[model samples]
Target: MPKNVKPVYYGDYLQLDKLLDSQQPHSKQYGPEAHDEMLFIIVHQVYELWFKQVLHELRAIYKEFCAEQLDDRALQLVAHRLRRVLTIQDLMNDQVGVIETMTPQEFLEFRDYLVPASGFQSIQFKELEIILGLTRDTRIAFDQQSFYNRLSEEHRVYLEELETHPSLFDCVDQWLARMPFLQFDDFSFWDVYQQAVQNSLDRDEEIIRQNAADDGQLETELASLQVNRDNFSALFDNERYKSLQEDNRVRLSQRAMLSALFITQYREEPAFHLAHQVITSLAEMDEKLTIWRYKHAMMVQRMLGTKIGTGGSSGHDYLRRTTEQNRVFKDFFAMATYLLPKSALPELPSAVRQALGFYFRHDD
Candidate 1:
């Protein structure tokens, strides 16, 4: 390492002067400053800082996925970085409580001074969403049109260009789709999986028929079981799965979904361990982000109730919609619905098992 030309001061290193000076509240311009406004500004500024760090980590992960191949080391780094993002998301969620310290009445004191600006205009957060594969079409109506219109011209153009690139979600889907284990010579893993699934469904139906209280309950249970049957069947039907994709019922491609299932099912094997960790981390990241959005929405309801946002959004209502719909990795969570018990899973062939492990037997 090169020696420092000049000894660095702690405050100077972090630009604390500018940071400390940035909390100039508009409330001070009219009359006696509202005390909570400073707190609000500081909280939002801290959020943006964290958003910047999250974007940095996401971009690195994206680059790794963009590679033609991801070795275990690369996968490990991706999982580690995703874990860090989740930790940051947890902190962000908890920060909502800090801002909630102010009452609605106190928020009203300075709220009027901040017109034409809202959380919707947070370019970094928007970029984070975009990089995580939130397409314009996938966004809610307000975000689809007005979100970009609200941004400055430079920011708008930049994000528009960014949308042209493959996002982290796209990269991950491609990576999983290209996984080589789905077809090993003549071995068809999905066929075995299908039979196991059918056997499990039959057992469930038998249990339901025996345990139902009455005719109406039996009918209801059978209908619900039929829905599961149809969904499981669709996993192997290309045309039916494509229809589900068109309806946005599922996001991952059929091949990728199957590959994810295979990895998840065989995660105990040496080769699949890191791959499963990466998949699990991505799912957890999505969950944490959803939790953050829910907390933020509740905080908005507490602060403004039915009032519209400063930037013309529907306040808590709009936030609630985003909390529910703006998900990129939800298919990972839904995959759990298709999992069978380990004991019921088809035992892999010895050769396939050897391929999925670190050691192989040597003939002398």
Candidate 2:
């Protein structure tokens, strides 16, 4: 059967090659302890690979968006990509749930062997943060302060090269500006917004597009975004605007549109609301991932309490900082409670403060 028909070589060369040899333990120390460490290492490596794919798709999706390639597919691709990310995140979350079962003294023996091998050096993780609309302005970027200094030059350069263009959210705004939908309803407004987003995506896949990835250009081309200053103010308060515009210098769009998206209430154009939804969803994903880090930290701390990390970090405290600082989409969380109805917004005081943690929403 094989000679007559050339067998289908079902091998994905790049993937198989990378996946098979990806997990490299720091030492020859192989025991039952290595079992959990291997589990720890393999899970993260696999997820980073997946994170790479997310960045690839995000860049492509963003490019299509900038070209004014409005359609429902554009919006859908994001959910598709993100759903996969969330699925893996859920898997990672479960992995954390499992790892958390380990005791502290058990973690101490080999923790020292892990010198400079912290997840903080994960290049792909940093890229994921950047693509999701986080920037260097946040505390995470300057984090080459500790074991993070262990980041390979390759990781550093890759991040430095990232276009930092208008993100998936910016693309959504460009799509929303195309139609005359007054509100975030299920009929014309929602349909147009949905279709326009998808249309933008399909247009990208089916056709050759341009370098519309940069927000500076996309904003100019799709300049008629209806959500404005007064509209933004009316739907939400001013601090809401500031919370959303944490990285005011990135210049994804004019501050008006950016803040309007994060802070403003749902006034017809679901600018703030959609941004709020995506931001919150992404933030949830980020929070889930932090669970993994904290679990890792706890393992290290329990095993080698108040000791140094294998990756040359301050161990528990270092990881605590990571868990606190690793938010890829901070504004989304900082402004989450505001996504609820005004009445509901008031009830969640902690969420309210977190959302307003970044900035004031007022204009002038």
Candidate 3:
């Protein structure tokens, strides 16, 4: 590391003056200052600071995934950075509790002074969602109409341009789809796995027939089993999987989903170790973000009840919908539906096992 020409002072280096002076509450501009308004401003400022750090890490991860080749070292770095983002998300979720301490009556004291400004105006947070693959078409109706409209013209244009690029979700899908381990010369792994899945389902049906207390119970269980059968069958059928995508039942492409499934199933293999870690981290990241949204929605409900937001959203209703609908990497969680127990999984050939070594081989 290069030595500084002069010693760096804490306040000056960190620019505490600008940071400390930035939280000027609008409540003060009104009749008398509201005590809780200060807490509101400081909490949100700290959240934006954390959002900046998360974006920094995510952009680096995105660049790594964009490369034509992602080595184990690069994948390891990506996983590490994602862990940091998850930690920040955990903090953000907890931060909701801090703001919730301000009672609804207390919040009402300064809420009117902040009309026409909402969390919808948070540009960084919107960028975070877009980069993670939330599109205008994917948002709720209210969000599609007003999310960007609420932003300043410059910010709206900037985000609209950002929407034109391939997001991290897109990059990861391409990378996973390019995996060559799906087929090995004449050995069709999926063909073999399909048979195993069939056997597992057959056994499940037999057990249900034997144990179901009534014919109605048996019929319901069998119907559900058929749905699982159909879902598993779609994994190998391109057209069916495409239909699933059209229905928004799954976001990852069929090949990418299969590749992710393969890595997760054989994660203990030498080469798949890091790959599995990457997939797991991405799934956990999605889970954490969803948790944050739910907590934030609950906090909004506690603070405002059925009232409209300062930014003109349905307040808690809008946030709740986003919590359920806005998801990337949900396919990772859904992959569990098709997974077989270790005992049920068909063993890979010795040749196939060797191919999954520390050195990855993409055979033509």
- After superposition, which runs of candidate 2 have C-alpha atoms over 4 Å from their true positions? 1-5, 9-26, 29-37, 101-106, 140-148, 163-280, 290-300, 328-364
Number of clashes recorded per candidate: 0, 37, 0
Candidate 1 has which clashing residue pairs, if any?
Answer: none
Candidate 3 residue runs with Cα over 4 Å from true position: 358-364
- Compare candidates 1 and 2 on lDDT and give the better one: 1
The C-alpha RMSD of each candidate to the native structure, in angstroms, is 3.0, 16.6, 1.8
Per-residue accuracy of model 3 over 20-71 as CA lDDT, tens digit each: 9998888877678899999999999999999999999999999999988887
Model 1 per-residue lDDT tens digits across residues 161-272: 9999999999999989977667687687888899999999999999999999999999999999999999899998999999999988898999999989899998897778
Q: TM-score ranking from best to worst?
A: 3, 1, 2
Worst 10 residues of 3 by lDDT: 355-364
**By TM-score, how accurate is candidate 1?**
0.96
Q: For residues 191-305, what per-residue lDDT tens digits would candidate 2 score against the true structure?
A: 3333443444445433322545676755654443223322234223446544545534222223334343324444333323333444445556677777867776776667667
- lDDT for model 3, on a 0 to 1 scale? 0.90
